[model samples]
Target: MHFTSVQCVQGENFLFLVNNADDESSFTYEEKSGKGPRSWGEINPHWQACKNGTLQSPIDLLDQRVQVLSHLGRLNRDYKPAPATVKNRGHDITVMWKGEAGEIKINGTEYKLLQCHWHSPSEHTINGTRYELELHLVHKCSQGNLAVVSIVYKYGRPDRMLSKVRRQICGIDEQLFHHIKSVDPKQDKELGIVNPGDIKFGSSRKYYRYLGSLTVPPCTEGVIWTIVQKVRTVSKEQVRALREAVHDGFEANARPIQPLDGRPVYQYP
Candidate 1:
């Protein structure tokens, strides 16, 4: 249903060009000037959802407010070790799955794994305290529905998955800046084969669920947010490597916490 123009074709590589010159999707995380989240509505009139949307994300998870629901069914995550590439998207480092590799089932709808990204200082906070990092595993169903699982990371031991990604990123001195830099492990590359399940969730499978929008622009509001309660640990060196991977002057790429605005947050046991 959706078609994109092939901008560049070289041997077997094809590049699809997306026209987002006038949208907030082109904006950065700078909070002071007109290019920030606060001015997204005025800058890009088309993506007014960024400012006016009620169900926005990166909310402060207040435990006293959530309703504990033990009857909610468990989410099925069928992720396999797949070939992936890492991209420095100006704001964050993202690991993208190559092809039809894995899928996750939520509420009976199966959403396939697309890509995973991180936010330094974390996007979601627990009771007003932010973690060292947050990893978002994004999935999409064939019907265009999105379901994101949020993993919180603290500083302690080295994380295997993160260490692998950090090793590849540590060598690159230049910033891609709106471009994707590939990491091919098969060719003895930087990134390694990472199973989605390898991401630590600690001892609890419990989480806080809510209906919310994307943290960034074009902030579509149908996204199902699954915020894990357990926190994992990663080494200080790993965190340092990730910080170095960011574009200049944009060290912290996390969006500010949004107001919950009376939305019901459920705790699934």
Candidate 2:
């Protein structure tokens, strides 16, 4: 059976829709035989945005090149506990939120939390340094504008919230590997409520902001990107869980850092 999450973004959600189909060869890992990041444009001619778009994401952040701006304002995150469903999208673990979970206010605009997912070895690099993992909290405004908050993860004390999600991801992987009945998260009462704020701990108002596109295909641009300056931790076990959750023997799911192409990235201090 296939599953598709609710479409709350202008009634559009593409990731789940694309993955539910048996043929996802249009996009896979970098090391895989099918279409990867490099071949995104080839997979679909409309995906020329991935190649032709000037404001592509997953760019390397050079500290020296960042402009200091004090007017970015404080990031107001008001995430409340809400029911969530975790799904192994065959590419990565995704947590689809339910109900009025929370919202964030930045630059006088508020964006509602939609979902969060993982990317191994991170996508954005800090001064050319990559971390063990990365978490992307996707949000969108009523106007259809998107703002993504990226938090890099380093190995250290096991995060309680991450640990809980890790267990579910690993379990889901096991069920898929053994060809067991697919677990319906909606019917599982034992699943814990997810509070996005739990992962925002230790993150400060300081962050790097820029205009960029989604890291995946159709590689749509116009996303407001905010990458937290502070790095968080997930235990080594959690790292292993995420790595194993990825199907195939591929070690990483991160897209290679793209060229900035003269885009201005600012640091709010």
Candidate 3:
């Protein structure tokens, strides 16, 4: 779906949301394919921001460029358990909450938790180093503005959240393997009641904040990105399972890091 900016309730700015599921066949991570990241904007008129937008996401969080401030405050979240479903989106595995799980308050504006997804080898980097995995907790405000909370992971212990839904993911993978052409791409496996809080953010109260765009098409900009500073642990098996669950070309689903383009990256105290 095409996304366009609209005035927010505050009236000081405009924001938009990426509200539709992307057609996985239309794009891919394989650079050999003409539908790779470099050609996303050219492939669709609505995704022009993928190539031309200044404030893009998954930027390398360089220490020298980050401005630390106590005023930004700790990452505020109030997520809860809700009826959810797990889906293999061809490109990645996503856990979608069926109801209002909870909301996170940012700068006095509330963004309700919508869904969370995984990206392997991380999209965002720290000090030029990419980790084993990354989880994006996506939120949206009443105005349709988006905010994402990201937690990067290194191989160690299995993630609590992933472990809870691994079986569902594996089942989907198995079904797709046996019936690749017949399995519905939009099918979702019921996850009963899953808690977003189970996805730990480590112990670090600090996080990096910036304005960016959706890593996927239509690559809409104006998204608020919050990347937690502490890199959590996940088992190698878990990471491998996530990679294997998606389509072959999407084994490594991370988008290439985008340039910061002079946008400010803030570290909260």
Candidate 4:
């Protein structure tokens, strides 16, 4: 669960505080960092049966049917700067933020906003070609089921909103910087930053969703995914900024796309 701010209803990391992007669950661990990402609960060693699981996430949507996902629901988002403890690839400009009360419509069920994050080289690929980055907005039902809205960024027009975040992508923090120390995600201003048609006017109403695991470590499975068919755009500089923002010296952190494995990768009409 993501807690936007610790003061939000006096947040608790393990309690799943209904709406907290800063709620510890939002933290990610990097094996390369050695100390790993921060967390509020016990982090699992790895996914089941597969010790070193490569079936994590961000697979290229190759040869799969392209279909659109019915706009389930949407929630307003705002971002603020939460600096990183350490730098990656000589970049210290990593930022983390909290999500506010946003709306989400999932299969006719309404859920509130929870949290969001960014993955370099957008995890899900289209026809085997990966994007520069991917931003995920996660929502959850009161029952704890999850729904994720993803935005894929490619090299093209530079996203102005991203420029606000450019500082972290370029800043260098030699030591570890706990995001919990200074967290805020400034959102909304980037609304039209992405092509409107891509979301509302997507050229193809195509998508592929299946039961899968988290792309990062621990690789938790059973996540109900909703991948959009339309691809979004960003600037090459944006990609470079992100690539340099982590402390792990990682040029890329996305997991390769996993197989369908007899699982019906659904396509929406």
Question: Which candidate number has the best lDDT?
Answer: 3
Give the local distance difference test score of model 3: 0.78
Steric collisions counted per model: 0, 0, 0, 40
lDDT of each: 0.68, 0.71, 0.78, 0.45
Q: Per-residue lDDT of 1-269 in model 2, one digit per residue for the tens?
A: 00011122442433333223223435776646667778886787667877888889899989877888787766678899788877666666677787677988766678888888888889999999999889988888786667789989898987666655545444443323222123332232224577776785464667888888788877777777889988888777666666675563346888889889887888877
List TM-score per model, in order.
0.81, 0.83, 0.88, 0.58
Please give, for residues 1-269, the per-residue lDDT of candidate 4 as tens digits: 21111111221221342233222233344535432333212344322312343333545566654443344223222322332221121212322223334445545555544545567767787787887777765556556555566767767766544543333333444221232112223212221122111223145645566555454434444455667667666766556545544533345655546665544455554
Better structure of 1 and 2 per TM-score: 2
Q: Write model 1 residue lDDT over 31-114, tens digit each, in one string.
A: 665577787666767668778988888899998878887766565678887776676555566787776659877766687888
Models sorted by lDDT, best on top = 3, 2, 1, 4
Query: TM-score for model 3?
Result: 0.88
Between candidates 1 and 3, name the one with more favorable lDDT.
3
Report the error of model 4 at residue 114, Å.
2.2
Point out the worst 10-residue segment of candidate 2 by lDDT: 1-10
lDDT of 3 by residue, 176-252 (tens): 32322222457877778888888888776789988888998878777888999999998887777677777743358
Residue 19 local lDDT, model 4: 30
Candidate 2: where are CA atoms >4 Å away? 1-25, 31-34, 166-192
Q: How far is candidate 1 from the true structure (C-alpha RMSD, Å)?
A: 8.3
Among the numbered candidates, top TM-score falls to: 3
